[model samples]
Structure formats: structure tokens, C-alpha cells
Target: MKHIKRFIALFFIAAVLSGCKEDMVTVSYPEYTKAFRNPMKGFREYFGPGEDKIRAEYPYPYGSMTKEYMQWNMIEDDSSDGIDKIIAYSNHRWKGVEDINMKVILRVLLVWVEPWHGGKAKDPNNPDDLNGWHWPKGISPQVSPYKQIPGSVGAYVDPKDKTTPIIGGYFDPAFPERVAKLVEKIGQAWDNDPRVAYVEMGIIGEWGEHHDPDLSTYWPPHDEPEHVANRTWVPGMEKVLGDAFTKAFKNKKVMVRYAYEFKDYEFGIYWDSWSQPQEQVRGYEEMKKLGDRWKTQPIGGEITWNWGDLAKFKSFEQVVADKHTREYTIEQIRNLHCNHLGGITWANFNDPEFRKNAEILQKAMGYRFILSDFTYPSEIKNEKPLNISFKVVNTGSSPFYYNWPVEVSLLDAKTHQKVWSKTLDNVNISDWMPGDDWTIEKEAYQKPAPINEIKSSISIDKSLPDGEYIIALSVLDPAGMLPSLRFANENYFEGGYHPMGYIGVNKKPGKAMIDKSLFYDIQSDKTLRYNLNNN
Candidate 1:
């Protein structure tokens, strides 16, 4: 009997040790495959007026653009309209933008210069040339009492008769006040609009570029001495527009043409001559001096190949095609931390080589969120908190400017359809930032990208049936509450969501048998209004 008691004691001790060993064993989480490019950050395609004709032609993701000529006259032609016209116009222009999962960068312009070459007849009534004088009726150019330069000719020559001189409307004393009032009206119309991504402070200069012959430092004074006084910025004009935009746009980010122009305000830059070698002094260097400003504000622009040293490239394609030029262009993009660029709107994306190189440039521009790791319990109890943790690394140059919501969902195990979803309110996705201080020599950021570990305790619905479910995650665009920003992960479903692993309610999950064939393509899924394809 005593021998039997000794054996029982030994067996009990062994059983206790086995139980502790099982409890202490670490739970293994599945590794997520990293993806390259995602949405809402790279390559803003140029969009113009026209509803049915305009389509997102690119494949990568986001379709966005800086739209010129939210012209003063087009929005509110008369003061008597009391901003009603602008509100109606904006509402019409952005009618289906959000539903299509697109964003527009807008600028209210006062002047647009028609593309002119010597000896070409200019038409003042050309609707296509939304250029020329855009100021509303009753407002006229205020001529200076004294000649700006003793015998100098005024800023502009009549388009029809080149010999006739005309003063630029920027000289009008009432222009600033009118612009301020107009800007306020624009804010009333667009500040809260979800379709609008950014507002460029573009009331001044031509094409809203903030550089007219009268206001540009880069453009040389006219060869004739008479045009010298015309090549200068309006005095105190910066403060007037700067203060107006600062006060008007509390929600939307505002971008200026130059970083130096709006020094006092925390405005972003829309450098028109981005990556042009000749613009190193006025453009590249000036923006580089801002240091980490790109973290908070966007740095975006177009790469124009028609002017200055850019002419050496001959064309946009040649610039991206040449190995040397392409590398330099990407270096500049990384150095300045650019978010989006224009000028590629016309590029032949069908060409394999051009598309390949373009993708490289696109990947380098904006936030590229990579899901490195994801963890959740193998079995989740009903009416209990399902704890989940994940790590994201932004491998790209810039941060996502907006704070969109992150969602955790459970997919039907057999069908792979989303069964339940909950937006994680605690996650501030915008804070998941990329590395900084890019080094051209190594072709890497000086600082290594930091990992963002997000932890969330989601409540499993008590009424949910006890069965296995595939767990997934997705970032919502907020405009449509649809999964818009895709994770750079190989585990992505055809829809925007990323499938992580499997979980069970009230039971251990069976082996995950993922059927890629069962997944529905986001493009064909009419139920989902957000179309992934350009069409």
C-alpha cells in the first residue's frame, strides 16, 4: 500500500509539470507577406472639368489631382450671389468624387495664362483657355499713379495687339480685400467637403502657380528695360493671402507655391519646378531648408521638362527612362519627401519599361505600410474580449497625411466573406510614420523605419454562432467607410481587406484552407461602390 502511495504522488507531480509546460509555451502568430505600393499617396493624376469623360487611368490605387481654376468668376461671378453660387458649383463639381473613392486638390485662381508661342493668335473668348482675366465684374486693375520704372511699359500687352500695354490686375488695391472675401466664401463651400483633399493658396499669379512675370524671381526681367518693374512680387500680398488661407482652411491642408513665400504660416509647398536642375537655388534648396516640415505638411509638384535645364531631358518619358535622370529624380523625391507629382498624367503607362520605372518612383513617394506581424488567439470565447496585436512599418518616404480608421474583422471560414467588423478607434494610423533624412549614396533613409505596434481588444459578439472564422484587417478611407488603403501584404484578399489567420468561437479553429478562387475581385464587386480598377 505504501509503494502504491509513492507511485501516485510521483504521477501527480509529473501531471502538474506537464500542465505548466503547456501553459508556458508561446503561441505562434502567422507572418504577413510584405506588399510594395498602396493607395492615397502617390502620383496625382490631373483632373479637369468634365464628369463622364474623366476616369482614373492608373492601376496602383489612389486617383487624385490638383484641379486648377476654381476660378473666382466660375464660382461666384457676382458679389450679389453671396457665396451661393460657389456653394452650388462646388457641390456639383464634387458630386460623385467621394463615392468613387477619389480626392481632389483645389485652388482658387484669379489668373490663368494661355500657352503662348510667338505669332500665335490669342482668343479672349476661348472657353478652353480658362486663362486671361478671371476677376469678377466691377473689379479692374488699379494703375499706379507714378510709372513703376520711369519710362517702363506696364506688365501685360493686349493679347490681340501686342504693342498695346495693360496693367496686371494684381496691382489693384481692392484685389487683396476681394481675394480675402472670396477665400472666406471658398472655405464655407469646401472646408468640410470629404471629396476635397487639399486647398492650394493659388489666388495669385498665373495658373495659380504663384509666379507670374510680375511676381516671379526666377523669370528674368524683360530684355527691354520697360518691363523690369513688372517682375516683382506684390508688397504685403503674401501676408494678406497667407492670413486668409490660414484662417479659412482649418480642416484641409493648404499648399503654397514656394516654402519661402509663406514663412510665417505652416503652409505646405507645391513646387512647380520640382527636380529641375536650374531651380536648385529657388526650388530644391529652398524646400530642403524646411528640414522636417514634410512630416506635417505635404511637399508635391510637377516635373516640367520644357524649361531651363529640364529641356536637356527633352520630355517627361526621357527623364524617367534615362537611368541617370531617373535615379536623380527619385533622389530628389526622397530628399524632399514629396507626396504626389503631376506631369506624368500624359505618360504612356502601357509601355512596360516606363511603367516599371514609374512604379519604382511611385513606391518611393508616399506612405507604404507593411504589415510585418499579426497576432490573435487561436480560440476566442464568446462574450469575451478578442485581443489582437499587429506591427506596421512604413517603408516609403512620407506619412499618410490623413488619420483614417483601421478595422478588424472576421471572415466566414468557408466562404471567406466578412462576417463581423469593428473599427479600432484607439489606433491613430497617421502616427505610423516612415524614416527621414534620405541619403543618396546608400539610397536609404538615414534613420531606420520604426515599427508601429498596435494593440486592440475587440469584443466578440456573444450571439455569434460557435464556429471557425478567418480573421482579417483593413484600413478604411472614411469617406465611404470602405476598405480603401490596402496593406502592402501578400495576404490581401481580392477585396481591399488583408486576411491574417483563423480564429474559432467556443472551439479550437480547424486548419485554415484559404481558397483564393473564392475571393471576389473588387473591380467586379458592384456591391462595393469603391472600384479598384481605373474604369
Candidate 2:
């Protein structure tokens, strides 16, 4: 009996040892995490380094010149109190708009509503130099203005303007109404009354500078604390102005500017008054309400705030932290959840340093803003010997330098086949100054067998079989010769759109044909010469 018991105990011990060994045994598992990668990091890896690096195929003259329009620059000087400077600037901007296939623009500085002397174009109704009435002014010398409201002509107005020169506020009563009148007069001057791209006021001025400190001052019978507690402007300012402007322009999208910039992968936010985040929220809320009515928009600007400027700070750590604070402030503003969130404007165009910051920030932020007109050419046509000419304009506030490669293709109208192909390389365009116009001219094949080069008018070759043909053009921005991502984006500016032009043919020709002249009369009409025999 004792031996049997001992045997059972031995068997139990062996089973326990086997179980421990099994628990300690190593097991094999896949090494990969199998998680998704970040999209931004992926984009960076794919594109390599720097901004505005896009690969595009540039086609030539046979393709239409997509960006064949022109531009004019007009600067407003603060020193000149007389309207002469303003008038001259306006005329210079519109110098050839009426005679060209382009749009007219008048750029000006947004300052306070102050008195000014009138020039030759005086108001016939108010003969007492009514144009000199005190106008709305912008706070802070830092805000950079780019957009305009339809009613104010091309000028941006501040909601806070007064008759006196106070530190932070405007002195004008009914400031909103005054701005509306300004917009109306300006629009009438351009024959487009009350311009629609209405006033984009910058939110950087010190709180309670232009008007009273309490919300009750602007909004009569101010009773609601909900509207008063953290309001930027008085309770009713935006409501009244937004309503009036919307009624007149019939368009929503009121412009509200914010200081926005990106540094070291983070966004920086600053207002005219860094002390009043609550007031800033009030202003943002007003604009948000307006945007809710139709489509609200937030126009972000890259105001000048350099960490290098803050070198006096105790340590580089503090300076970097401050810079980071600015970026975080903007992120907080975006979190406010307003509609029509407009893109950022990288302030002064002439500064190269500003461009560098804009480039990186635009990529990191995933936001977009317009750079006016930046498209390549679209269509090109020829008779026998052909010459093509077009213009490119830098509508943004900076210069654009890039090599344009042009390709010319002749298509068969009947069979839809390519008969001739030629690519022009290393076409260098000198500095395209902001708001300045530049032209491009090229001459291609000159064989005029089917038509006479002189007697026949300029027309596309129609001598291939009975089929439709088109000439196309594209551009490759390998060197990143354009502006930052904001200006170079395909969605924001036409500057990056490839394959902009095309030409078509119908049948074989038997007569002399003339080339299309690039000349335009004062009325802005095209002069075309063609041969009936080719058709």
C-alpha cells in the first residue's frame, strides 16, 4: 500500500513539471505593426524637400495661353494726404484694363477715417470736397491688406473709425454706415456699384481704442450680457454692418483678418492687441455670426513677428516658446468652428524672409488662399508660317521667376492624329513683379504652301484630312520657380495648371492664309485674318 501511494505522488510531480515548461515556452508572432502611416509624412517623403515643387509637362503655342491676361500695381502712400495720389494710383492700375482682356484692380493702404483734399475727380453732388470726409482706419502698422469689398471700390475699411486721433479707437458715429457709403462711392467710380468682395477688417487693434469700453456704447439699449461679456466690438456693430452690406452687395463672405503664421511645424497667432483674447473671441464670434447668415470667411494674415527680433528674451528656449505660443493661438482660433474659413495671406510680398515662412507654413497647415491669376497659356493657332504672343501677370503680392517650357503640336481634324510636334525648352521669363504685366512671344513653323502668307488671314492649318485637331501646352515646376504652396496650389491659383491650351482643324487647304495678329484696339477686340480657300 505505501509503494502504490509513492508512485501516485511521483506521477503528479511529473505532470506539474510538464505544465511549467509549456507556460515558459516562446511563441512566434509577426514583427510588423500593421498600422496606417501618417499622410503628411508620406507627402513629405514623396515630394522630397522644399515647397512649390511640382512636376508638370509644358506644352507650347499650339496650346492656348491660359494666363494671357495682364496686371497693374497701385500703391497708396500714407504721407500724401491729398486725393491726387489715390487718383493717380487708381489710374495707373486701370491704365490698360479697358483695352485688354484683363481685370482692373486698385491697391491702397487701410488707415483711419481722416480728412483729405480732393483732386480733379470731385464729387459733383457734394462740391465742398466731400471726398475728404474722415474715413475708417485700420489699427496697427503690422496688418497687410490684400483683398477689398465691392462697395468700398478696392479699399478695406475698419469698423472702428472716429473723427479724432485716439490711441486705439475710431471717433466716427455710425461707423458702419460711413463704411457702407465709402464702399458705395468707390464701387460707383468703377461702374460696379458696391463691390462684392467686401471689406476685410484686420483684428489687431487695441481694445476700446476707437470707441467706448462697454458693449452698450455701440449697441443701443445693450441689455444682453451674453453679447457683452467678451465682445470685441460693441454688441451690434457687426450685426448692423453685416446686414447693411449684405443688403447692398447681395453677397455674404465678409472679410475678417487674423494674424497667422507657421514656425517649426506649429502655427502662430497674434492679434492687434495680444492682451485681449476674449475681445478677439468677441470679434471672431461676430464675424462667425455673419458668416453663418451666408458664408462666413476668416482671412488669416502673416503679420511680422520674428523670433530673432525677440533675442532679448532670457533664453532661446523662451523665444522659441513664445513663437510656439503664437502658432497655438491660431490653432485655437480655427477651433472656434466658424464657416467660410478663408486661407492665410503671407503679408508683405516684397520680403523674401516672409516668403520662406509662408512656404513652410502653407505645407504644414493644410490651408489655402488665392494668389489672383497664375495660369499658363491655353490655345495656339497658325496659318502657314505662324507667330504666337501672350502675356503673364503676377496677381499676388510677390515676384514669380520660372522657366516655361512650351510644346507645339499640330493635330489632324479628321482623323484626330498628331502630324507635327515641337517642344521649346528653357524659356526664361524675367522677374514677374507683383501686380505687373509681362509678355511671351514665339514663332513656329513658317511653311505656307496651302495659302499665301500675306493676302490670307491668320488661321489654324485646315489642310489635314476632314477631322478636328487641337494644340496643347503644359508646364513643369521642377525648380519651384513660383511662389509658396498657397500661390502655387492648383486649386487656389492658375499658376500651376498644366495643359492650358488647344487648337483644332477641319479639312485640307488650297489657298493663301494669314496669321492671327496679337494687336488689340482701344476697345479690346481681337483682329483675325484668314483664307477662305483653306476652309
- For residues 328-373, write the lDDT of model 1, one tens digit per residue: 8888888888888877756676687777777778778878887855
Candidate 2 residue-wise lDDT at 120: 27
- Clash tally, candidates in order: 1, 76
Off by over 4 Å in 2: 1-89, 92-180, 189-198, 201-240, 251-253, 256-298, 301-357, 364-497, 500-535
lDDT of 2 by residue, 270-350 (tens): 122221244445444443333222112323222223322333444322322354543543343333321111112212323
Which run of 10 residues does model 2 get worst, by summed lDDT?
36-45
| Cα lDDT for residue 128, candidate 1 | 32
lDDT value, residue 115 of candidate 1: 28
Worst 10 residues of 1 by lDDT: 22-31
Best by TM-score: 1
Model number with the top lDDT? 1
> After TM-score superposition, what is the CA distance of residue 414 in candidate 2 from its true location, in Å?
19
